[model samples]
Target: MGLPMPGDSLGDALAHAATLLLEASSVDDTLDAIVRSAAASVPGADHVGVTLAHADGRMEALAATSDLARELAAVQESIGEGPCTFDPDTAGIVHVPDLWHDERWPAFAEVAAQRGIRSKIGVRLYGDSASQAGLSIYSARPNGLDEESVQIADVFAAQAALAMGKARVIDELHDGLRTRQRIGIALGILMHRYSMSEERAFAFLTRASSHGNVKLRDVAAGVVADFVAGLEQPGGG
Candidate 1:
């Protein structure tokens, strides 16, 4: 979808963004689309970045529209302080009207200013038990982003989060299907080799997985590999 025109209502703009983001085919594509749409829609957003923060304190930049945006995210990750590094549960949106004068994150602000970023806004995207996300908008002029910009960004953040969550669910479903297929192949191999029933083959796989302290999928994969190896032996087939 294209950027919203002048005098367009916030609802209309967000609806368009949601439609564009939901059309993304993968998690990476969803993230890229979110950043690109944000740059086009959020006011004074010269650069945009999406950051994921894990409960274990790891921060990563998932997508960025420019090198400057990526650099700022890296600085936050290195210093362990910045709008993108804040606790999503306890903090509200962060707005830096002038990075040079902002004191909340001196190290981050210093680095941002050095990179020619004068203003910034950070909005929480989504938060769950294990991880959360933040959207960072950067501008080249002081006071470039105002309250209205924050309001606009908040809407975009919600749309981006929804898109990301949906993409993750899709990935999980695809992974589940692959795991089941691999396990089925392994079970077939075991049933054929030992003349065992399906239940007995599954139990055998379970025992091997527990004894080896390996995941069931990994254990199943090993069984399939062994069967293939035996087939390749001299006069084995």
Candidate 2:
């Protein structure tokens, strides 16, 4: 089986690709869609790459069009000069177009040239809070990413980033006051029943997630579900 191709024109391609992102049921699905879109939309964009988590600590391309682009982006991310904060150039990472004229990434440039990549464009993925996740796009042609292509890529990046940012804020982040209040009630029960401290109770829940090989949020969700379930029962404590 082959992956779907969106369109011939860049705009049509992006519009089609946007449908995929919109249809995505999860964050990972949306990002994977973006990478595939970039590779397919622009002419000669043989490779595409993107960073995951886009947060401050670490940057990594979750999806890449080729092993070479992926490796280079990771190297730049590892060096810590790339777009941890979302720089427009190189998409907060490293990009090499005519490595002969550009030696920004000495080692990566060598590797890119050896890999036969002549031009590349990296548009950083940003969050609603304006944080960066990663960059995407790569090419084997010398003049692959022209102005129009870059603009189109930027539109794609902005749309995907906005969607992803919204999803993260809703899923991973919460209004702390509300979350703390809801969890505090549940934590209080655990502490009273098990003789644990505030911090210890939270750790116990965290460890339960680790022990069960699940997410802490999943554990918290279960706690809330059980609390709601208990309230429905007769004489529930």
Judged by lDDT, which candidate is best? 1
lDDT tens string, model 1, 72-180?
8788888988888847465658899999888889998888888889999988887777777889899999999988899999888888888898999998898899999
Query: So what's the TM-score on candidate 2?
Result: 0.61
- lDDT by residue for model 2 (1-237), tens: 133364456666777777777766556776677777777775567777776534454556677767876776666666554323344343332344565456565555566667776676766565444345665566667776666667777777777787676655555554555666666776886787689898998998889889999866567767878877887899976
Q: How high is the CA lDDT of each candidate model?
A: 0.86, 0.65
Worst 10 residues of 1 by lDDT: 1-10
Which residue pairs of candidate 2 clash? 54-133, 82-92, 83-92
Once fitted onto the true fold, the runs of candidate 1 whose alpha carbons sit more than 4 angstroms away are 1-12, 128-130, 227-237
Q: Output the worst ten-in-a-row residue range by lDDT, candidate 2.
A: 82-91
* Per-candidate TM-score against the hidden true structure: 0.87, 0.61
What lDDT is obtained when candidate 2 is compared to the true structure?
0.65
**Candidate 2 to native Cα RMSD, angstroms:** 8.4
